[model samples]
Target: MATGTQPPASGTDPRRAGHGVRGATRAAIAPRHLRTDRWWLAPAGTAAGLLAFVVYSTWRAFSNSDYYAAPYVSPFYSPCLAENCVPMRHGPNWELFGGWWGLSPALLILVFPLGFRLTCYYYRKAYYRGFWASPPACAVAEPHTSYTGETRFPLVLQNLHRYFFYAAVLVGVVLTYDTVLTFRDEQYAWGHMGVGTLLFLVNIGLIWAYTLSCHSCRHIIGGRLRHFSKHPVRYRLWGWVGRLNQRHMQLAWASLISVAACDFYVYLLATGAFADPRLF
Candidate 1:
């Protein structure tokens, strides 16, 4: 021992002997964080943007009447499983939930895509900083006294992100089908196209980009492979996914905004706000 120096405590780093470890002790700093510049702006902006989307999506989900127009259906209400769906032909016609179910058909199907977003790894970072303020930004101290991470209850459900990825893929497929259906006119003629069709095309494209770029999708395509040389096909696909994954955050926001805009366009048409101008 060096000249009456105290011994290092258990489960701590020697280099950080004077500094604090999370869940052990607070650092000797006086401020909440030592950031000098405008560090709070990013988290504040994230919180505002996320809150706006939640409010808009929640309102649209409940007000389901305007979500469906001929040859166009909102992404939020696709695979319309209920019999009561407006213009039921837009749906699969299976009516899995039966006519007895009276709630918005959007509610029935939104869970899958919603679950996918809620459990998304990127979104976890987003909301944890934006909504929860759990260490809102880099080097910032969280107000929470303790952190359990995603180990308990609702947060633990994040492990189901992989499963939700499958559901999101299915939803993407359904949205593609819906977009294809938009090629037809109200008379059901196959040769017609409209401005809404273009919007649908753009929205679905963004949706697929976001969905395929998911961390879970990347893992499913690339994980568990010990030898890249042994599987050239998977390796190529993994590389492609890796490129997309780099833009995951941008794709996430773009797709979210596009889906909402697409649905809003459908709502405008359904409400007789204007006629969908034909491109043909």
Candidate 2:
């Protein structure tokens, strides 16, 4: 009798029986899911929300008119430093290019906030799934053959997120100054508070919440530490930031809505469509 190992069954390849083949030519096969839920809904809603905000903000930013009301300036046009900006008693008077730039004041400052959000890690994930449909949801196949990731040309700009965060902080300072200025009436006297003032306060609060809750801010607070015990202060600071970071996504969306609402409120006041009720 021959003692050689027996041949495998007719249809079975012994080497391929249990393990996945290396360097296989065949495309990957996705597994079937038990749940038949509406997975597209979340991405669809995200896309719609983002689109609506973009449209509204773009229109308001370009409008240039009715961006200010006494004791209230639209967050879109705060720190109205452009020469083309409607005359304001406060805010910087510096205008570039000999004041010939006939652009909305929002144009000068919106870039900072926009760049910060654009390069935000949370926002990148949100829009990547929402707008690009890059594997829109789990279990769904991506439209692209492969992903180049953020290491490539345009996406490489994401590395500027930390720098944008610094600019955002400066912009926040300017906005805070604008909010403080809101306390004074048109005559510039103090002791005035109105619904507009409340709006500005809430808007700034939400902005700070969003900005402080950033992952980059968390890393800056305490990254590359060899030992937590050695840096007690940084450890505590990191703890606080981590708590905020846990809710960063919520803060981000809330801030977005609050800012838009605040801008719209100022617009209404400026347009005489609505009045700011006195709280005090």
Candidate 3:
């Protein structure tokens, strides 16, 4: 009855004092919110879209079929270096392992672009919100009790994004070469253009845009520079990359769609599902 400590004021919380609500008891609530605003739609759509692409691409990669048509190779199977790669279908046929391994040709090359996208800054944010529901949306609360962030294990590998960017650039170069080769006919003679050629060209352009607009590329171009006057060329390059970075999200999605579309187009041509119209 004569306790020295005073009770909290009628309308205020004692636990909310300097340390906001650290040890406060949580309300026994059901769902976080009851308002009907279609909040779950975004993540749902993202999950569905990404899942469809993953399934289709994985199937195509493992099927190892119809990845190439004369003068056009699917972006999924470019730089075909496997011995199992059909000489007529996948081309290149670098025979890197000399027919020893009976693996899918896509196994040899999809990793670079896959790694690039997996570690992409925008993709990381997209999937984190889309798939993991790590605080899924703007006002949503995460299901976890603690936050560990990206400082450990699998997430830590995100640091390798810069290296993956390098690999992606080389892959882009290979794809560009494939695009150039598309100018030739089945006999390797130049001056041919088809519906497939434009598709490959557009796909490569989108990929280059996406890759160049990457956050890692932006940093490499301008991160540590002290004085812009000292390096006007680098500064100018950085400015260009900065502009692209501003649209990185759009480019990322555009490239994803285009790459898949390009591969599917080649698949159709290879399977004779569709005839490539000559644009020449």
Using lDDT as the measure, the top candidate is 1
Kindly list the per-residue Cα lDDT of model 2 for residues 135-187, writing each as its tens digit.
68897777888899999999999999999999999889988998898897767
Stretches of model 1 off by over 4 angstroms after superposition = 1-27
lDDT of 2 at 185: 79
lDDT for model 3: 0.85
- Which is the leading candidate under TM-score? 1
lDDT of residue 94 for candidate 1: 46
Off by over 4 Å in 3: 1-36, 89-93
Superior candidate under lDDT, 1 versus 3: 1
Using all chains and alpha carbons, the TM-scores for the candidates as numbered come to 0.88, 0.88, 0.88
| Model 3: per-residue Cα lDDT at residue 177 | 85
- Give Cα distance to truth, residue 250, candidate 3, Å: 1.0
